[model samples]
Every structure is written in C-alpha cells, then in structure tokens.
Target: MQAVPNAFSVLSHPSLDHSGGGRASSEVPRPATLFESAELLKGGKIVGIMHNGSLYRLQATKLGKLILTK
Candidate 1:
C-alpha cells in the first residue's frame, strides 16, 4: 500500500451535472487519503489506531464492513 501524506489534505476531482448537462463541469473536493481497508488491516481483521494518546479499535465485520470505536 502507498503512504498518504496529510490525510486531511484536499484534492479536486471532476464533478457531473453541475449545469444540468450530465457531464463533468465542476470540481469536487476530497480527502487525499483514500485507503483500501485491506491495506490498513494488513491482512488481518483488526488493527489498533492511536490518536491523541488514546487507543481505538478498527475492526472488520463478518459482513465485510468496518467499525471503529474508542
């Protein structure tokens, strides 16, 4: 997986239907960090995320979803 610099950084992407033409006519802002769950999980179903001196749980559910909790 690739490293993301400044997870909060904003980037722009093409937007559609801004002028009701059904075409990309505008730009949309998105976070720079767009990561696949498997990359963060690192081949596992769970991983610990640390923030502000606190530990959090990041787990993959059996239904193929993610849940993060403090």
Candidate 2:
C-alpha cells in the first residue's frame, strides 16, 4: 500500500491579501514597537507588514490578517 501525504490549509496568505481590501484600521494611534506587535500577536491579532513604519489591524474578519491602516 502507498502512504498518503498530509494535507494542509493556509491560515493566512501573508502576501496575497493581508490588507483585506484596505479596509482594516489601526488601534494604535502612534507607531507601535516590536514588543507591542508581539503583544498583539499573542492576543491572536494578525501583524501586518510595516510600511513607512506603522502597524494596523483587520477590521472586518476580526480574526483575519493585518494591514497598513495608516
């Protein structure tokens, strides 16, 4: 008999749609530090890519990927 490979599902596409149509917003008014981001991540919040030095969160899904709200 042949062994079957395990299947997997992508939780989030880090490149494709982390922004979520640019609708998400940032809770932090000022620039967030790495430690802050870590805290957010620990709370199950997606950490968006830093662009021009800013952090944001997903507004729609509430559990989706992060985006540059600023």
Task: Write the residue-wise lDDT of candidate 2 on 1-70 in tens digits.
Answer: 2322321112222333355674333442332222333355666545455666776553324555445465
Kindly state the number of residue pairs that clash in model 1.
Answer: 0
- My TM-score estimates for the predictions, one after another, are 0.56, 0.20
Task: For candidate 2, give the lDDT.
Answer: 0.41
Candidate 2 Cα misplacement greater than 4 A, ranges? 1-45, 59-68
Global lDDT scores for all candidate models: 0.72, 0.41
Error of 1 at 13 (Å): 12
Worst 10 residues of 2 by lDDT: 4-13
Model 1: per-residue Cα lDDT at residue 20: 61
